[model samples]
Target: MDVQKTEIWDTKMVPRMSQFRAFQQVLDRTHSHWDLKNSNDDHYTAEVRRHTVNDFVFTELAADPLTGNRTISDIRQSDHHYFCLLYLEAGDGVLRQGPNESKAAAGSIALWDSTRPAFFGTHSQFHQFSLLIPHEVALQSLPGIEDLCGLNVDGNEGTGALLLSHLRQLHDTIDTIDTQDRPAILRATVDLMAAAFRPSEEKIGGTAFRRALLTRVQEHIIENLGEPDLGPQNIAAAFCFSPRYLHRLFNQFDMTVSDWIKRSRLFRSRSDMETPYLDGLSITQIAMKNGFKDSSHFSRVFKQEFSMSPRAYRNQAHNLRLS
Candidate 1:
């Protein structure tokens, strides 16, 4: 099979600098005493004595990939950073604000939002792994996720340990992961990562429900590509989703769900034209039967897509077969 990219920046740094700039942003704020190393083709680390000294280290480590570099305040109120998705492979401490103290250690995941000031201080040396996903991707995995920004993913045991183990595996093997498994791994990471941060039973069930619902929609789309009634409302009602949330899923793919339905239908129609056994069916009849109300519109769209009308496409295929 032709290779798909699953390139790792840690494993390939010379040309990967551009690819890894965004990942580097998560470590922006290391205190002055922290050892520093920045080079084009080198593995870098941002180590510190505690997880909760300050949150400013993130933007400094990042510089500026999406938003401006977050500045370190002289008299910081938050022992933690303003905005971050914090994960630790190993460490221990208590992050404090007012009367609440969030436990920090290995197997822990916590989200800090810059939108609100917060604090979490690791009492001792901390080992950290983190990411600065775009605000858009963040919301995709956790709709209305802003509500849980300051909350810590409880990590004493169970699913939290499972997620922590996965992170450890990812960190250890970031050097050598197969390319084809990359997308699935990334998606699984997003699912488990979100799970680590929220412990509410209701929230977990909700995430699972959405994931299952989307999977079913995908199955329906593939199975009934020719039925035009497969429009947004029917889909939304079938899956018990609001059309708005349905749009969000399509938005992730840079398509309107309706547009994808039409595109899929047209592709299937064109494929049908090439079948010699179906020669008894005229191209116009095939188009009309496969969800096209206006054959002229179908012709225009098909020609624009394939650079030939449906009839020409069939003729070209037929000639190629006889030759």
Candidate 2:
């Protein structure tokens, strides 16, 4: 619940000659240590309002034209390990992390990892919201988060739009929200951010990239197992891959996409059948809930997979629990 506001640089307080140095000191204290260059030293103006909500830090920054670079030395000397999610609210800029360089226009979000070197610059005056997410928390939500640095999350469409709206609302209401509720709200924001980032078409690189992407796709399928219309075509479309390419990706694991979906659904259904809390639901209800359309077909597949009828399995589970 701690909030800190810093007027990073003011033309009147700090003379033109000493403005850059004073700004650098403020930047070091308020944000990450960056090798900063003033694009408009003659007209320097910047301010920052920072709020610490549990493990996350939400910052609002407005500044004149400038560029900040995190060099190798800066990375090595700094102990900060976090991911920065920067949303440009008023102006555009170019952000570079690793070999990836992307344009971050207004209403767009860009991610950068603190452990790596990066470059950020704005051509004109800009206002932005930057959320500093601890590394462990970020990785827990999106294991492939590092790959997202230097990529743009389009805030105008889909989940990105939702995330943008959430961020703006959070910015407006953070002060009024109760301290106990801040953590939950921040966690939900992170989840929405992960969802927004995941659907973007990641660059298909070498073996490591492919392996990570495949794992992500599998995780996505597992999460959506109950969707009746979940199939290779839709899955492929969701991940921005062609159906044929998706099939090829699954083929590498000696599993077909349809078979994987069916097996996942069957296993999920079996688990639900055995759960005591789900006992009130009938067998056919459980089957259809896990994406099976016909009761007879669900029975045949249940037997094929678990060697038992769904009803018999549920009964056995209930008896075992009683014993």
Candidate 3:
């Protein structure tokens, strides 16, 4: 992330979270469970740049506290073991910080810069939503925050909550962020975040339509996977595409209309087979749901692809799931 260039991605959803967890190395962040008791990995990636440092803040409140007793997972960067504003927001519960412990409930904010270390303790399950923004982004306006660096901003009201509300909204709508509108959204959000620190907003740029269009297309496919009529022609019609033009799109993936839909149905059926939630769905029923017409044909195709009959596989899955 070159501070000179502008790039904003909302890597803030469960799918992105799984990807980040799978590839924490991209984050280049480090974490330390440098306090008392039970131990675990100090580092984990929360997003591309932002990291979550679990109990590091809480350790300040108490080495031992009243609660279910918690463990801190350092969600942070490998570079800059220290940061200016180590902010945290709670999805729920009472979080103790500084001289007074406050409940962040929902839509609340807490700020902590590196200089004066802050500690926190949460009652019940201490799940935290945190961000490690760049020092440049944090200290943009409140240079005096050097003195107030580690102090908690009363994010329960006014500017802080407003900023938090924005963060929460972005976090919630991440998967649905339209690429066509992303540049505008990223620009506005960056400016809004900058302004929250009461700093002059940074000049953000726009996105190219080509990339945005591709994103829009992928989103369409993912959202409509279950539509039995979601063949290339159907999709093309929905997108106002000519059949020939739609065939060109599938050609990129080296498949024609029918093959693509068949493979897609197989994949969805395979995914469902892994879950007990589909226990009531007979193999034929599941296949029919995904557009397969005949149970015997469905079984043969499934067995060839997965090395097992659909019922045998479903039974195995159910047994394993039970275990």
Candidate 4:
């Protein structure tokens, strides 16, 4: 995606007083309502950069202090059922939905449902990244999402920290990432959020927690596959989980942590080898590229998993393409 084409709205393009109206117009198009508290023309400024990938929408918004609402009346006016996960990059705010209210500070995240009446107010200049997932799509991953509405997840520790870090990275690289990869990245983001919100042992039970943790760990491994030191201990430390606990989480998957990493590396290597664009690359080069320090060990694992050498697999792919 072109970086310049990524921005959908900017206050700089409009006059001072019209800034709020322009922002509202963009919000209307997305089936939401905004009520700007600071009606003073001199004080209003805003910008939104939106990137839509499949059913998810990643938006970066910067603006002066203001209040917004998604009410039952508003919902009737425009019925686009969605769930928003807002991560604050700067400033502070409060969100209220039904009986729950939470304060959101920089590095913190808040979840809100569009089908319910909700209100959020920014108290100062603010910058935020919001991931809008369709209600149906989010429900598929997080069945108990209703229990999380208006809840604030602290992004400084635990799965929340990992979720925040991954979101920031995605926001930073969304434009540069291949169009084919965006959907997978967005799906992973949703999975991480579902995990981040269900931290209570009693609420999600032990099994559910383990599954979410496994998903997060797998995502971390895939993202860092190129790092030679990417292992259970380092990955555990990254998410503030103990090495023993990390291994325990993978037990239910019937695979050890090391086994999963090796499998993932081999899978990626096979994918690259099958690509005609990389056909000219040597097997050893492909092995190292996929984080295999020793080509001999990679070859051993590849043949064990696929019953064929990497070179043989590539040759078969070439022959099939030629035919």
By TM-score, is 2 or 3 better? Answer: 2
The order of the candidates by TM-score, greatest first, is 2, 4, 1, 3
CA lDDT for candidate 1? 0.54
Q: Is candidate 1 or candidate 4 better by TM-score?
A: 4
What are the per-residue Cα lDDT tens digits for candidate 4 across 205-313?
A: 5675576677677778888898887898899999997999987776643568898788788878987886878878899998888889999999999999777888888
Q: Estimate the TM-score for candidate 3.
A: 0.34
Give per-model TM-scores: 0.42, 0.60, 0.34, 0.60
Indicate the worst ten consecutive residues by lDDT in candidate 2. Answer: 1-10
- Model 3 bad stretches (over 4 Å): 1-215
Q: Model 2: residues >4 Å from true position, as ranges? A: 1-12, 199-323
For each candidate in the order shown, give its overall lDDT on alpha carbons.
0.54, 0.79, 0.46, 0.79
RMSD of each predicted structure: 14.2, 14.6, 18.1, 13.5
Task: Quote model 4's TM-score.
Answer: 0.60
What would the per-residue lDDT of candidate 2 be over residues 1-323, giving only the tens digit for each residue?
Answer: 33333333444577877776777777776567899997555657777666666557778878788889999888766645678888988888999998778998999988899888999899988999988887756765664577778988889998889988898898888768887877788889888888887633434333756767777888898888878899998999999979998887767555788987887788678768767788899999998888888899989988986677888988987896677
lDDT score for residue 199 of model 4 = 48
Candidate 3: RMSD to truth: 18.1
Encode model 1's per-residue lDDT on 1-323: one tens digit a residue. 11222222231332444433434432333321111123433333332221221111221121111112222342232232233556765566554333334666666766655434345444443556654443433444554356566556655587777876776676555336675665566557667866666435464344656655655776687576667567888888887878999987666445688776776667678657866778899888888767877889899999876677898898987895577
Kindly list the per-residue Cα lDDT of model 3 for residues 21-113, writing each as its tens digit: 433322222323222222223322233233222111111111112232112333221223233222344334443323444454444554544
